[model samples]
Each structure stands twice: as C-alpha cells, then as structure tokens.
Target chain A: MVIINGEEQNAAGLTVAEVLARGDYNAARVAVEKNGLLVPKREFGGAVVSDGDVLEIVAFFGGG
Target chain B: MIPAKEEMLAALKERIGGDLLEKFQSSAAAVCGLGGLGSNIAVSLARAGVGRLFLYDFDDVDVTNLNRQQYKASQIGMSKADALRENLLEIAPYTEIISQKVKITEDNALPLLKDADVICEAFDKAESKAMLCNLVLEKLPEKYLVAASGLSGLGTGNSILTRRVSERFYICGDGESDVDTCGTLFAPRVCLCASHQALAALRILAGLYDV
Candidate 1:
C-alpha cells in the first residue's frame, strides 16, 4: 500500500497518472516529486509508483 | 499603578524604548481583506500597538462567516471592515483604525496602499490575490507586502509556511490547501500565520529585516 496524501492508497501496479486521476487532482498545477526527484508532468502516465516511495506534490495558487 | 499607553511605554522603555514605540505608532499598515486570515492579522497587529490599521473588505459578514471568521453572530449583517474595527478597538482602544468598505481594484489599490509602510494581502480568492500581488509589486515598488496563500485544512503542523518571495514581499501559510477544500479554519492555524505576518511587519518597521 502506498500513501497518497497520507491516505493509504492501493497502487500495487498503477502509474502516477492513474493515481492522480483516482485522487481527482489537476496535474497541470501540481508538481509531483518522488524521493526528491522531480517527475515531469508529461511522464506521469508512464511513470510507475512504487511501494514505500515518499512522494510530495506541490500545488501553486495565483500568487506573487 | 495603572499601565496606560504612556506607562506601558515607560515599562517597555528598556526593551523597545519610547522612540521605537513612537515610530511604531506613527507607521501605518493596510490589510486588504477582512476575512478569516485578515481578521486575525488585523486584530493581532492592533493588539501589538501598530499605529494605524487601514482595513478594506467590501463584503458584509454573512452567516457563513461565523465558522472561522473573527466576528460574532451578532455582526452577521455588518460590514466586515466596520466589524473588524470594532473588534480591534476592544483589545486596544487607542489603536487608530481606517475602515474602507470597498474592494481592492487596480484603480483604488494605489490610494489605499500609498501611505502604507506594510501591506498584508489576505484576499481569499486566487484572482484577487494575484491581482493585489501584481498591483502592489508593480504600483507600490517600495512598500513591503506580506501575502498569504495555502492556509487550509485541520492540521496545525501543515498550516504555516513563511518564505520571502522577493526583496519587498513575503509569503506565509501552507502553500497548497485552500478554503474550499479545508472548509473553515481553526484559530490555531490562523493565529500562527497572523503571528508570522505581524513579526514580519515588526521587523520591517524596526529596520531589522530589509527586503
């Protein structure tokens, strides 16, 4: 079980795009980093999420 | 025996001194929104003895605002700026308040922020937040603006994040979550962000923190 936003997520063999689609988040405004490595938005569909992976997604609002 | 403003000044003589207090009292800050975050920030600055607080919020307090906003149920139909001014005076009667019950647009942004040494951008909507940010950055080149974003949710640990965005600007709060997702905010988080903002204002006023 992987944790998406601290919630236990069932991502046994799912890609990052599938995970985000399941979570109902916009990929455009969010930056996904896995284990401190930046995951490009274009690769989300192909990038596979592994177990015990520490992922941080940062979203930006309209700000200065 | 009684610590009036003068005596309070005398007591803080060694720590802050009369000269600094005088400067603090003469300096002005404009808070652009009187919503949840703005309300808390305004009250905290007023209590901290910031000389003049120019508050702007076009909306009247609705019943929905009682959840996390600083106003009471009795103030539901009142203008947010007026209600905030009244609330702030309860804590420090001598703190001067300038209530502007109007929205911050490009036309009026300069006038409202012209004399402001520090500006607290507390607008909730992203469009308004961006508008104010650009307005202050482009129009008021010298003023220090502390803008808040990403303050949402229930956890205290995730509620406060302060970063200096530019030479004259600082950003505080979670940086991701929003009011729509988190619903109403708790005082703990709001206070944390407000305290951070007030500290930034103080440092700017004291010439300790230059952007």
Candidate 2:
C-alpha cells in the first residue's frame, strides 16, 4: 500500500532497508525521502513504510 | 563618456526582452565552487545580465582543470574565484561580481547565500553537494537551490537531464553517470550540465520557475 517513486507497492510493514532491497536499489548511493522529509541514512534500517506512505529515492552521481 | 544604465543594457534587453531582462538584472545569484560547473554558471549568469553574483572557492586553478573547467592555461595558479570573476567581467563588465577565496562550510553558508535570490551548487564532491543541499533546505528554506550531478564521461548527451527534486530544489545531469563508472569527465557533458544549472537559476530568478 505504499507508493514508491510513482509506483504502487504492497509494502505494509517493510522497513526502508527492506523496500530498497526488494527493489534492488543500492542503499549506499541512494538518498531516501519519506513523505516529503529526507530520511537520514542511519534511519533507513528503522524507518518503516506504511500504507499510503510515499517515498522518493535519489542517487548521487559524481561530476562538476 | 559614461553611458546611462539603460544604454548599457539596451542590447541584452532587446534580445531577452525588457521584462525578463529587468528581472535578471535585479536578481542576485550565489555560486558555491568555482570549478567547471560553478565557473560556467557564473559566466552564463553574467552574460544573461544577472544583477549581482557572489562566488566562493578556496582552490587555485590547476592545469588539470582546463580539460573540463572554464579557465584558460594562463589562469593556472590563480585563485578560482578571482579567475572566474575576471572571466565574468569580460562578458558583463557592469555586472556586480563578488569573489570569496574561502571554502564554504555550514558555518558560512548562510551569510554567503543570504543576499542571493537563487543558489547554484557546483561542488565536485558528493558529500559537499549533499551538505549544501541540506543546509539550504534546512536553514535558508526560502531560497531556490540548483545543483548538478552525474555529468561524467563522454556519455550520450541526451542522457543528461534536469529534474526538480522539491519545491525549490532542482538537480541537473543524468542520475546515473558517476565518475567512478566513467573514470573521467569530458568537457561537453560537463558544460551541458552546467548550462542546465545556469538556465535553472535564470528561470527561478525570472519567476519563470516558481520557487
């Protein structure tokens, strides 16, 4: 029941880490935002994804 | 004879039109880092007749930076902020340019960014970029922040993209092209991303992009 990056997923009790793992996203390179707030990297393990929650995960690329 | 202010802006005004040009001339822009992206952002703003520019960089121009950065061989050994200021002046002599030869950290980011209507983040490090983005979103919540990333290697030019991350944060460059993957940055892609940052800043300044 979570919307991740515009796609709906049945993530009722998944932690940020679990959701990321399910999607095969590299946690090290991606920054996560949950409900318009940035989730600190350390909190991904504890941050949970509930029904109707929205998440946007962004990745960093190096350049000038 | 010192021409009137209107006379100085007539040519640019004719091109960009009076209204948008006026907005540009009245806006102030802050560029953090005078490297490849920062230098080009500064110069692009200058040519677009941005009213004032505040630039920060503690590094000196190195010969290696000439590959993708906006600098000349003669500029090597010069401070980046000063060297970039010189280049900006060549394009828009009347544009007010402020150069700071100090590294911008969380402590000084606010004061340096306060006067600017829009902010351009052009640091080379991902950590630095994240720091500035966090600082602006947290402290200067009202300011618009434009940043660049993923512009490395000679990838397909079409791969580079500009994305709006939030209400006031815009990111330019492909989300995937990292230096670790490409191993080197080519000039064309870097400049394309820089140009995107510059255009984003201008759009925010001109009220074309809502902050």
Report how far off residue B130 is in candidate 1 (Å).
0.7
Looking at candidate 1, what is the lDDT of residue B138? 61
Tell me the deviation in Å of residue B160 in model 1: 1.3
Q: How accurate is candidate 2 locally (lDDT)?
A: 0.85
lDDT for residue B19 in candidate 1, whole number 0-100: 72
Q: Which stretches of candidate 1 lie over 4 Å from their true place?
A: A1-64, B1-16
The DockQ-derived docking category for candidate 2 is: medium
TM-score of 1: 0.72
List ranges where model 2 is wrong by over 4 Å: A12-31, A40-47, B1-5
Worst 10 residues of 2 chain B by lDDT: B1-10
lDDT of 2 by residue, B1-211 (tens): 6456677799888899999888998899999988888988888999899999999999999999999888999999999988988887776889999998999998988999999999999988777777787677667878988988799888898988788776787888987777876789888888999999999999888777753
DockQ of 2: 0.55
DockQ of each candidate, alpha-carbon based: 0.09, 0.55
lDDT of 1 by residue, B1-211 (tens): 3347776555555567777777788889999888877888888777666789999999999987776678999998999989998888777777889998998898878988898899998877766776676567666768988877776566665557776654677777778767676665666766677677777887778776753
Clashing pairs in 2: none
In every candidate, how many clashes are there? 1, 0
